[model samples]
Target: MERFIETLMYRSRWLLAPIYLGLSLAVLALGIMFFRELFHLIVEIPTIAEANMVLMVLSLIDLAMVGGLLVMVMMSGYENFVSQLDIAEDEEKLNWLGKMDSSSLKAKIAASIVAISSIHLLKVFMGVKNYDDMQLMWYVLIHMTFVASAFAMGYLDKITKH
Candidate 1:
């Protein structure tokens, strides 16, 4: 009975499989939104200011970073918690697949967040005339928080490795 219970407990990890699959749908949705924005940018190119165009580009970049983060977390989290993914040798494969452990995944996530925050802060700065000083200060503070968190996480990871 004890052995059976342990086996059942281990198999329960499969419950997360559906959640990871759901992230794939999210990736698809983001892809659609990205292309939609791209089309809009193209159509408004002549009418949009250069700064506005830059801001749009930054927004797209932010989306891409977030999409990447979601994919990484979904794939790595599933593999680490559920089961190994078997792929044929001849098939195309991701170099980092099966390589990122939970710690690495956390670091990657933190780094991605910092990158997204940096892009957002840049956009805010670019549109400084549209925002009050307090708002701009808050944006900078938020970005700094992300930067500090990433740095601390990296430091902790390094210490743990040693």
Candidate 2:
């Protein structure tokens, strides 16, 4: 019975496989949204005000960053937690694939979050008139929190490695 239970427990890791697969759907949805935004930007290019054009481009960049984040999480999370991917040796592959452990993946994710937040904050500031002062303050504070958290995580990782 003990041996059987151990086998069951180990196999339970497979449960996460479906969850990781679901992230692909999220990536697909994000891609659709990105193209939709791009279409809108292209269509409005003729009459878009300079500021609004900048804002729209920023929005597209933000969406792209989010899409990248999702893909990184989905691929790295699966690689770390589930079975290794079986890829052909001759095929073009990501340089970091199969190399990122959970710790590095976490750091990368935190850094990506900070970058996304920065872009978002810039977008908010670009259209400052649309937001109340209090709302703008909160946005900056929240972005600062993300920055601090990422820094602390990197520091901890460095110290732990030593």
Candidate 3:
């Protein structure tokens, strides 16, 4: 029974294989969405007023953040469960790849969440006239919570490592 359980545990890693492939598909989807947004921005260039242009730029920034999140998940997930990418010493490499274990990945994800939240917060700020004070305060509070959580996690990780 013990031997059988060990084999099952070992084989569980293969389950992650499908998840990684799914993430690849999701990445492709994000690419299509990004390009779709890009085309819209191009078409709306002349018609979009200056104020709306800011909103359009924010949309682009949101897409960029999502893309970054996808890349981080895909690369780190592959390295952690699947296999190390055969990136060479001289090859152009993302600095954070391979170095981020699950713990670091969690922290990075938390930080990214905070960043994306900030972008949203900015949008709210820009549209303050449309938002009630109570709603605006809640958005600020939620963003602060994310920031605090990320900082606490990073501090804890640092302390535990040493």
User: Could you give the C-alpha RMSD of every candidate to the true structure, in order shown?
Assistant: 1.1, 0.9, 1.9
Model 2: per-residue Cα lDDT at residue 141: 98
Measured by C-alpha RMSD in angstroms, how accurate is candidate 2?
0.9
Best by lDDT: 1
Better of 1 and 3 by TM-score: 1
Model 2 agreement with the true structure over 1-162: per-residue lDDT tens digits: 999999998888889889988988988998999899999999999999999999888889888888888888888888888878888999988989899999999999999999999989998999899999999999999999999999999999999999
Question: For model 3, how does the per-residue alpha-carbon lDDT over 57-138 read when each residue is reduced to its tens digit?
Answer: 8877887887788789888988897778898789999988879998899898998999899988988888899999999999
Kindly give the number of clashing pairs for every candidate.
Answer: 0, 0, 0
Off by over 4 Å in 3: 87-92
For candidate 2, give the lDDT of residue 125. 93
Residue lDDT tens for model 1, 8-43:
999999999999999999999999999999999999
The C-alpha TM-scores of every prediction are 0.95, 0.96, 0.89
Task: Estimate every model's Cα lDDT from 0 to 1.
Answer: 0.93, 0.91, 0.87
Which pairs in model 2 have colliding backbones?
none
Stretches off by above 4 angstroms in model 1 are none
- Candidate 1: C-alpha lDDT: 0.93
lDDT, candidate 1, residue 99?
Answer: 94
